[model samples]
Structure formats: structure tokens, C-alpha cells
Target: MLDHEVNRFNGIEIEAAHAPEDPECFAGELAAALAAWEEAGRELVWLRVPIERAALIPVATAAGFRFHHSQEDYVMLVRRLRPDALVPHYATHYIGAGGVVLNSRGELLVVSERHRRSARPYYKLPGGALHPGEHLVDAVIREVREETGVHARFEALVCFRHWHGYRYGKSDIYFICRLTALSDEIIRDEREIEECLWMP
Candidate 1:
């Protein structure tokens, strides 16, 4: 059998590095592996192929492997050995953060977005989506600076909301953080924000 990892469930994850360089060899090995896994009661199978191994994609597809998701460096594929087998979906939530910044003068910092579904100007907190591996405190501070060019530091996590069926049918978790402004500059991201100001 090809090199693999067994999880808690009746599933096996094939190692990409163990995959054969030749398509014919891979096909033969994969077919044999599938048969052995079926007899071994394996339900789900996961295979990740790096971009450099593009030639193996067609071979895998011919063996019933379907695309699960993709990344910059690799593509993941999955196959269910049994008819009623279950494979969970990929990451389902997008993370976001908003900053509630207050200055020493007791003024709140806010902004109006450049593009929106509504025609009328609607002012809101200055913040946006968090990057991968970004901390809540850092994300809130970064978002505030990126949106309004105001330097700020995290004070506390004021609130958060989780909603289903957001953009692209995925859920979203938005963190609202209270922050103290370090700078009062009103420079805004002209591409993203129409206006930005400090209101008392």
C-alpha cells in the first residue's frame, strides 16, 4: 500500500511524497491501495498533490478522486470508499475585526465605505478582515490603521457576532474591539473609504 496516515475515523490520508513519478505506476498503486482500503473498512480517503506533480491529477481523477480544495502550493482531493461515507467540508468561517477607537478628547473614529450596496452614506467603525494567523489584538489595530491611517492600541474585546450564510455561503465571525487612538490623523484609504473623521 502507498504511504498513508490513519485518523480517528475510518479514513486514510495518502502522502504526496510517496506518490510515484510515473502516471502508470501511480495508477497501478492507487487502484491496489483503494481495493485494500475497502477491504480494511476505510471509508474516506484524502490525497494532496503538490503543483509540481500536476501530471498525477488526471490519473487521480480517473480513479474517482474529486477536488476538495486548493492552495497556492497544492491541491487536495478526496474519495469516499463507501456509498454512505461522509467527508466534512473545508474551513467554513471567515474571520473579521472592527475597531472602536476613542481619542483622549473623547471623540470616536469612524468612516464611510467607498463602495456598498446602499447609495446613502453610512458611517461605521474603521476595521476589516483579519489575515491568516493574525491575533485579535493585532488584527483590530492593523485594520484601524489600514482603513483610516490612525494608529491605535487594543483596549478590550467589546463584542462579537457570528452569522450564517454570509458572503459565498460561508459563515463569518466578526470581532469588535475597543481601542485607544495613538494618532488622530484622518488619512483614509481612498480606494476603500469615502470619508473618515473623528466625531465627538
Candidate 2:
């Protein structure tokens, strides 16, 4: 078992604990330490536990803590020090390059990449690379409009996957799913896009 203290961006002090061998035992200790921190005027307590060793979840819930979000190697849970006056901080990260999946009815909108000389043709979603200093959402909207000629609004973040190859410079990629209303109007730009259509 190990413990550490850290400060959040909102100035709240957090106490975190981890146990490699016995998660149940560490959960009890973590609850106790969190109570102590709360008594000392800390605003919240953060916890990290492996998804496989999820026995700590019940203990934390019994101690009034709730699950937050999980990313990479950490799963964070928190208990608010000020129950009625809690305000969460929103931190946005650019999702590198962005692409959109437009689901209309039961079909997905896709674009056909034109064959250059003797190269093979390929199919892909309508989106493109992000410009410098552009947010992921804004970049996605711009790319979709530029490629497909349809205005769009962001609905939800569905899934992300990486694309790796020599042509793309072996960079990590992010595929974003967005829901937008469909229209019959077609806007085609010859330079960057070849053709667009809806397919199952």
C-alpha cells in the first residue's frame, strides 16, 4: 500500500492511495485518510485503482465517494468536501487529428478517395487534418464542412482509434463520431475531396 497527496487545478487538496496485493484492506485505509483530509478543510479526495482490483469501489461508495472518469493508467474517484457548493473544472484536450462519422438513419456517410494514376481507391470518413491552434471540435466542424459542404453540430464523442502507416507519418489518430441532421444539398470541392455519399 502507498499514499500520496496532490493539489488539483481548482486548489483542492487530494489524498490518493493504492494497494497492489490487498485492495480491500487499502480501501479501508483510504477512506480513513480521506476523512482526515476532509476534516482538515480539503475540498476533495482523489483515488486511483486498477480496473481489475475494483473491490475498493464499494468501500469508497459506502464512504460517500463516487466514480469519476478513467484515462490511460488511472481511474479517479472523488468525494466532495462541499456537498452543496461543488463546481467541477473542465479541461479540454485536443484529440490530435480529427474525423467524423455521420450516422443518418441506419447508414454512415463516407467519402471515396480518387485513384491517382495507378493507385488503388479507398473509402474514408469526411474530415481532415487540424490546423495549428485549432480545437478538436472546431477543427472537425471545419473539416467536415470543407470536405462535404454540409453544416454540422457536435452531438457526442463516440470512439477514438489510432491510424499508423508510412503515408500518414506513423502519428496517433483520433476518429470522432458526430450526429448531424441530413440535407439533400451537395457541396463538392474538387481539390481536397473527390466525392461524398451515404453508405451502410
Candidate 3:
């Protein structure tokens, strides 16, 4: 185990144990290291665990570490050792984009999903998941067009919400973008979207 003390960031970066050793022993080592860090006044610690080394997950979880986020290659685990930590921990972060579109007639655009896992259908803003490597603005525009079949111009970032234990057991960052409809024509993906309407 190696510690990269990032004093400037007010945190320490710890690498997951990768010596091909017993997991129980490593768990104890990790716990001890965490204690040492806390004693040293370190405020935060981050551990990057590759997907293949999933065995280490139990070790970190047992040590009170929480999930932060995950990429295609690895999962990020975080622990807040002290209350004054500068950065907040959000494990497995997901980004979703939606558009709050208004037409010239002062009507709002809304959509209903054709099929969902929930008990009943829910109408919401026309939007969906952002594509990998896609910009937030671009994602919202694309999602709006796909779901509502309307071309819209993004005006501003209206708001966002942080959801814990969201869909698929992942933390979600939901973006509500303000938009102005460029065209009144409404088109929607019939397979995924059941309805699109202009509401007051």
C-alpha cells in the first residue's frame, strides 16, 4: 500500500492493495492505514479499484468507505476522515439531462414513457441519459429532440437535483435545462415514448 499525500487538495490518495494476498488480511491493513491517516489529520481519502479487482470492494466497504463514482475501467471509493473535508463524496455518479421547453404559445412540453419498470407511467420533461463523452448541453438537446420530436434552443441551465440510491442503485445528477422551442411540430419515438403534449 502506498499513500500519495495531496496536502494541497486536503486529502490523501490511497491505492488498493494489489499484492495477490488474502482479502481478510488486506482488509485489516486497510483499516489500520485509515486510522493512521485520520491520526495524521488527513481529511479525505480516495481509492481507485479496478473492476477486475472487485474482491477489494468488501474490504473498503467494511472499513466504512462509500462509493464515489465509477468509469468504464474502475470504481472510485471515498472516505471522509474528518468533518472539514473540502470535497463531498458521491459514489457511482450518473448524469441525466432533461429539457424544460416552452413554445411561443406559452405552453410547456412534456412526455410519458412507453414502458417503464415502475407501477404506473410518469410524465416528465423530454430528456434521457447523456451519451458517453457527450456534453450536458448537447445531451439535453439530443434527448429533447429524440423524445419530443421538436428542435429547441437551450437558454440556460435551470436546475439540477442530486438523487441518492437512484435507478440501478446509482447516484444520479439530473439536469433540468431551460429551452425555447424553435418549431411547434411534435414528433416522438413511438417505441420508447408514449405521449408528448403541450401543457399549461
Give the per-residue lDDT digits (tens) of candidate 3, residues 52-156: 778888888888888888889788888899975766645477899999999999999999898777868778899888887899999999999988889999999
Candidate structures ordered by TM-score, highest first: 1, 3, 2
lDDT of 2 by residue, 112-148 (tens): 6554443666677777667767877888878777777
**Residue 106, model 2: Cα distance from true site in angstroms:** 4.0
Better candidate number, 1 or 3, judged by lDDT = 1
In order, candidate lDDTs are 0.91, 0.63, 0.83
Cα error of candidate 2 at position 160, Å: 1.6
Ranking by lDDT: 1, 3, 2
Per-candidate TM-scores read 0.88, 0.44, 0.57
Off by over 4 Å in 2: 1-105, 115-118, 163-170
lDDT of 3 at 4: 54
Where's the lowest-lDDT run of ten residues in candidate 2? Answer: 9-18
TM-score of candidate 3 to 2 decimals: 0.57
| Highest TM-score model number | 1
Model 2 residue pairs with clashes: none
